[model samples]
Target: MYISFLFSSFYMKTEYVVLQILVLLYDQDVLTEDAILAWAREKEGADESDKVLLQQSESFIQWLQEAEEDEEEEEE
Candidate 1:
């Protein structure tokens, strides 16, 4: 997964390796949902692309939460 931020005429790219590391951290419970959401919100700006990303992130987070609840119910 490639995540990039555009500022002015320049584009900043986040490396795939860094994303993989973040995934690992999340899997280990080192990164909480609130933390991820906060980070995403903080990065959001007036750019259209940024707004799209924020919306996607919110959707993804909701999906994750619902999946977790389903799993817990199944275990019960």
Candidate 2:
């Protein structure tokens, strides 16, 4: 039980780190959405939960893009 708990905690923390990296890449425009998706899909031990998190990250990127566009338009 202790081992399982430790593994679960480690997995959750790793997932959080992965999500943060994705967001950072998005913010930097270092990777396109397709590239990000491909990279996530290629990650070891990726599962449905990871897919869900990726979706959330994509949505966030989309939101940020739209917000930036809106600001640019407002300034024009």
Candidate 3:
């Protein structure tokens, strides 16, 4: 992923990886909901350090799940 390679140890100061960017990418269709959910839920191919980063986005992941549920219900 671009994030893992684009950022180095020096730039991973918590603030560098804006969790909101995930939402923006989703909104823009640059990233699909399933892909983000897979990354967050299974940490499919994440390295050890990147796994920690995924943990940091836990709340956002919950929000995504809730939002998806809500949208599905609305469509029903």
Model 1 regions lying over 4 Å from their true place: 1-14, 46-76
Candidate 1 vs candidate 2: the lDDT winner is 2
- In candidate 1, the residue pairs with backbone N, CA or C atoms under 3 Å apart (3 or more residues apart, or in different chains) clash, namely none
Question: Compared with the true structure, what per-residue lDDT tens digits does model 2 show for residues 1-76?
Answer: 9999999998778767766887788779997766754555564357776566665465555665577678889999
lDDT: worst 10-residue window of model 2:
36-45
In order, candidate lDDTs are 0.60, 0.69, 0.74
Collision pairs in model 2: none
Instruction: Please give the lDDT score at residue 23 for candidate 1.
Output: 61
Which residue pairs collide, candidate 3?
Answer: none
How displaced is residue 16 in candidate 2, in Å? Answer: 0.5
Local error of candidate 3 at residue 39 (angstroms): 1.8
Q: What is the C-alpha RMSD of each candidate to the true structure, in Å?
A: 7.6, 6.1, 7.4
| Error of model 2, residue 74, in angstroms | 15
